[model samples]
Target chain A: MGGSSGMTITTARLLRAVTLVVLLIFLFRPETFEPMLALLVANNAPAIYNQGSLLSLTISHLAIAIAATAAAALISVGFAILVTRDFGREFLPLSRSVANIGQTFPPVAVLALAVPIVGFGTKPTLIALFLYALLPIFENALTGLTGLAPTVREAARGVGMTGFQRLLRVELPLAFPVILTGIRLAFVISLGTATIGSTVAAPTLGEVIIAGLLSSNTAFVLQGGIIVAALAVLSYDGLTALERLTARRTGRVATAV
Target chain B: MIASPRHKVLPALDKLGVFIAIGLLATLGFAPLMVFRANRIVLGETVDIAQAMPPGPMVVLLASIGVAGVAALLKTSAMMRLIASLAAIAVLAWVVGVSASFLVEGADAVARASPASGFWLLFGIFALMATDALTRMDPKPSLRIGLVLLAGLALAAFLASGIWDDLSVMREYENRAGSFAREARRHLFLAFGSLFMAALAGIPLGILCHQVRAVRGPVLSVLNIMQTVPSIALFGLLIAPLSWLSTELPILRAIGVSGIGAAPAFIALFFYSLLPVVANTVTGLAGIPANVSEAATGMGMTERQRLFSVKLPLAFPVILTGIRIVLVQNIGLATIAALIGGGGFGVFVFQGVGQTAMDLVLLGALPTVTLAFAAAVIMDALVDIMRPSGVQKGSQ
Candidate 1:
């Protein structure tokens, strides 16, 4: 923790606090920005999206993102753990390809395809988000588990730790930071992607943006974009800090995470 | 330690292969091979494989499935597994084509027949098995590149033969053949054009960041923040400003700049492309050995000469990797750009979604997947071929 520059941390915290305050104002009080929005658009165009509350839209957006990302993390991390074991090693190659190939799939296409099988609404969006979030978490978990020093494992064995005990106590702890980085990535991606759920009748911030687009209301578009971007940037910074703390605790040198 | 009796009794199984084979068998037995819709937007009825294909083609398909299954279950060599997998895929394609022809017989222009969940499942399983075999065999880089080209040729041939003309997605294509070509050209242009612009600006910025300690922190942080902004949001944010600019400035309007079109989308993609290119450039340059640079200095080469002749050459591969990442990323993002009238494959995707037509969605999606996959594979092979032999050896 001390290795990091104090000045950067201070500036980051300041930025975070400012963004939070501004977001709160935007969500709770649209009138504050309506004047500015009015200036941007013509007189006839609506300055704000009045059909849905911004706060509720933000909440629903977050709810879907969290649920999908949590589910993806659980399944993907479990699969990674399973395949790394001796009995499941034969599946390593297949699992790797599945994760890699899944990433190559565009999120928009995935969401679009899901509508055919599941029909429209939040169900398809959730399913798509889950599938989209799986790759990064799985890849990171596999890397974190497999990249353990062989000597560390031998040392644990020398100390008479059973396989389960060693895995629980040492492996999981050491891999936690890396796995958390994956979860952060997955969460950020899910947050952005869940905004597109509006196309399929899911109540999300995307509804605002899509509505704005259909009506050619630039104010509505800008408002939706601002809220979503704030959520992403703030959450990303918070997660990075958490990841760094965990890495420091585990004595792992953090690189770009 | 004595080995367990159960361990001795059980032969080691290729579990992934077995899993795929089981999925294949399950799909064959229970899932529908095709769907027949009375019209484009109607809910389709599932058609069984037995009802769709004639006995001769059915027998051939069954034989290929059996071969794939046997090769998967047995302790077969990689070559045998690869052959079985590819043959099974080919047979599956042929049978699907036959089934489409059979199903569409005497149907009106509005009628549609398309591969259902079962056919897709089989395709995915066989593709997985083939990939596994290829990975295990670890073919030479040149051979891998050749294989991708061969696959592309086979796809072209498949399309040219009109075997898939009766399929619903192909019908969607037939209806909009002109627009489909235009959108495809637009998609390629957006993807490649943005990449070219990004590389033009990014490489130099990357070098600047690497050389100047003061610029690195602020520049990278800004790029990181830009990256966190969703593509949709970025496009939206650009609309107001760009439109305002175009309205205020006649020169910009004359150049085709607009609020909610290609201009905003293009600019957003350029911003997204910068982080990867710049970061990779810095990394590649920083990776040069101190001794090598010192040697160049000792040879009395000017700073500019050392940079262009020595540092840039060493960093080329890594920079190329960054370009590959950006290209694949930009291709995927360009689809979303269609929402704001950027005009790419995404136009079909969003349109299909609005119309609730699955075939139209597939028509848009399948090509995007293929393009991204091909880009990744070609770039990977290029990276492998371009890497210095000594560096490759040392890394391994």
Candidate 2:
């Protein structure tokens, strides 16, 4: 106990302190970061996000992310339900391959390929994000649904519930937590990947990162990195919390709970 | 949707099939099959290739229409569906050759000829018909492989026939073939080199994290935080530190560590690989059943012997899954490395974007997509073969 007390600087505490410092540098005084850049760079150029407020960049980033994730969720979940049904059973392998096509596609290639067809800005980024997010959501939804206890589904059928009714009332609720896990994975990953959207004029936090890259400015990179990292951690935690909460509420999802 | 007594095949979507058939017929009848151009990439006066080209390939067109019509019938034979799809694909290949034949003949007068919207829609309908037919037949893997090989052979025959010389995309490829090959090789080098470095660093780091309880939490959290940083930002962040290293340490600079180029790209990719490798390693090691280790010990194996012989062998496949993910991901991220003069296929993509040349973009994109897809399939097959039994599914 004495030895433990002697060293009060725990790793967790250090991590917390470092995180706080990073946040302060990102949000308040980015000037504090310039010195580190000056130390690292020969031509330490100051990088800017835009002439406008950084808050707008943050919002635009979040907006695109949320919109794309939401769209992906809607389509992926529907497709999952479709492929799992008796009529759509034959499409199961094809669906898996198609969803994987999104993952196999590099978002950079998707972005480059998109610009010619979709033009610039949020449209292309959203398309890329939508494609990038599909695999996780689809795979997870399939797992969640397919992994259901046969007895529970049998009970649902025995209870005279129609296919749609069982999906809505029994299967979906049971699968909700696993589906949320997929959403969480997709959301956090998208938070990082959406930065690339700024390259195609999507006006995300990547704008700062790209600018910093071009100009050799470490401070701008830190500013952008800090925000994105924080956003990822926060969203990851928040989604996890939501998952746990829903798992608890849906007593059927006993494993995660 | 009802299944007839003689129709032994699965329930077919006759409505959708018929709709697509009608669409295919309309496309062939009304829309110009392919457009001819007088200059490269310039939208010249549109001439319908089907109407203007000699020997028309009318027989193939009529065959495609007949196949589509038969497949759309209420109770078509599975054999008929297979023939329809194969015919549709054959027609697609033939149409491209026939369209390019005119441009090839008038190579001096015509600089380019491209498939217009009609061709695209027709292709889509044919592809839809093909997929529908495939789902019906559910052909064996060997049969599917044969079909793919046959299609590839046909396309190669077309290209070797020199009939597509006036196609704009091919023209772009012709100009950049030398640099394209070089860039493709360098792109591969960067991906493989980065993965090698990642394994070198990550595998041991993972072992350390797994063995050392004190380091596990901090190491994992740090890597997690590292992963959350966007690739662009991480690459940007590395430049300054890397440049500093080069400037401050002359010996390091002598080895070609620099502010830009492959050094920073490799560093960033290394960071990206860490989370998966380390996490999977930790998971794999911790997941080892207690009895398995006890049996090794009971057999008089030392700690090193147990780890090497028992734990590692048990864990290798799971750890391999992580490496597979990293390898595919690295192939993709290497494209961004080109932006920093790291020399990859990305040069063409970015240059195309700059020039607003879509064909140039395809020259880069098509290969990158193929590389990524091939890496994924090959790795999946490798993992399956290495297991020999069956994969541990949800655990991965």
Candidate 3:
């Protein structure tokens, strides 16, 4: 049984490697799959998107999602930490409600609203992404920090650890895996959402799909959809792996809330 | 550290309340309360709250907010804080409407007036403070539900009152009243219709997975992958296969199962809704204690009878939670359905974006947010109410 499970892991890794290679080929040399795409698209013309290289579009898409998720992580984690502490404990309900209510605003609506306030293009997209990504990370971080076992906390205190020292050295490490899961969810969400940023004239892969829709070209939409989906899936898998590794190291089973 | 008589003279302040009050004051003092636009599309010049309102009422309103702020800062009882915040919010709402009317008094018929940053910030700050007070007060669940209904009705009446007729959003609504109604219905159809389909399919699939353990892992993983596909991509991907089907089979086209419009959007939303419903159903069923199942069997209950009488009743709240999640999520996602010509509130959103008309964007966004929020609140209340009484402490 152990050997079979190990074999399954090997097969999974091999499948992942093949998927990565295919994704790279599709992004950099999409024409290699053109004959097949032509069969799917009904357009005899070049099935590959020509306005911008798929590689560049993928990079910009990753950049926007990464930058927004990073900023959201910093702010949300800091705010969560603050609210969990003694001085900021009064704000917990406010924080929880804010996070919950903010999420009820759809990502597309939020992005559209941002365009009017911040004006068009990448800034609005970034702002929307940052705001939309906030709730999960904040909620998860709060859960992780506050849900710590009382005995473990007391043990840290018994070791003569100061509040700050205990939080930094003990609580955070134990909570890291859960917090990472939140960041993972946030990142994947941002990656998917950043596609819509193209509507606001942000240079992202959604530009490809929207352009395709405008011209009734299936190839463009397919190209954009494939790359975006691949990136999201791959990144999600990588993050899940990282989460598992950290959970194992910390002697805690990471659970998604 | 000793309690001192001198300390009694000055009450310890509520820090968060003070922070929110400061935010309100700063917004009123600095930010523009409204914008006066010459027409629907152009960027408008901002009008300060004081400048936009008549002096007498403006001064009175400002004074009320100041009083509220002081009440917040003084560590007053929760009841006092709640009343103060509610009063302040009422004043702010009236002030905004009056200012909109004031700003548009002599402007051309085509000209528009809309609430600006100061108005939004003030309203948000006060509402937060009110909610905070309410949370601190910890009202009964029934009271909370009643308040939500009352607030919804008040908003409907407020809109119907025509006090906001001068606002740009109201102007947009006036122009598209017929289409707005159509789109609103379509949006509801897209959200609720897809949710209905998902529940129909998902509950059965969940039962299958729970009963046949062999299928559980594969089924969940596939659903997880479906979820990972970004919504836009999923919607986009559906177009090709669906369009081909519609073209290949004229009968499907007749039934309106096309690549674009509500069909793909419905299908995509249905797919998105499946994971939560199925997962929760499986969890809910599996979570039934083994002893309970044994007792049901010992009572001479058949498998079907055991499921209906014992297991499902216990799991209903959990399943409702999943439904709540799907409902809120579908409401939000329905906005994106408009991208595929699916026709929801997103039509106004994208059009407003294209035209650079902020009010039009607000026309779409505000409703979507409100609907999602209302759904969440109602669903949450339902979940709370439906929880089996014995499991109350364990559930939370």
Q: Each model's C-alpha lDDT?
A: 0.85, 0.76, 0.85
Q: Which stretches of candidate 2 lie over 4 Å from their true place?
A: A1-50, A252-257, B1-55, B61-94, B101-110, B114-163, B394-396
Candidate 1 lDDT tens digits, B1-396: 466887777676677767877898899999999999999999999999889988999999999999998898777899999999999999998888889889889888788899999999999889988998988888887888899899999999999999888888998998899999999988898888888999999999999988997888778877877876667778887887898899999999999888977888899999999988988888788878898999999999999999999999888788888988888888888898888999889999999998999898898889998999888888777877777865421110
The 10-residue segment of model 3 chain B with minimum total lDDT is B387-396
Root mean square deviation (Cα) for candidate 2: 5.1
Give one digit per residue, the lDDT tens place, for model 2 in B284-355: 788777888999999999998998888877777778888889889988888888767677888888788777
For each candidate in turn, the TM-score is 0.95, 0.84, 0.95
Candidate 3 per-residue lDDT over residues B95-156, each given as its tens digit: 77788888889889999999888888877887787878887887765777887898798788
Model 1 DockQ (Cα-based): 0.49
Q: Which residue pairs in candidate 2 collide?
A: none
- The per-prediction CA RMSD against the true structure, in angstroms, equals 2.9, 5.1, 2.6
* Decreasing TM-score order of the candidates: 3, 1, 2
TM-score of 2: 0.84
lDDT of residue B239 for candidate 3: 86
Q: Of the candidates shown, which would achieve the greatest TM-score relative to the real structure? A: 3
Instruction: Order the candidate numbers by DockQ, best to worst.
Output: 3, 1, 2
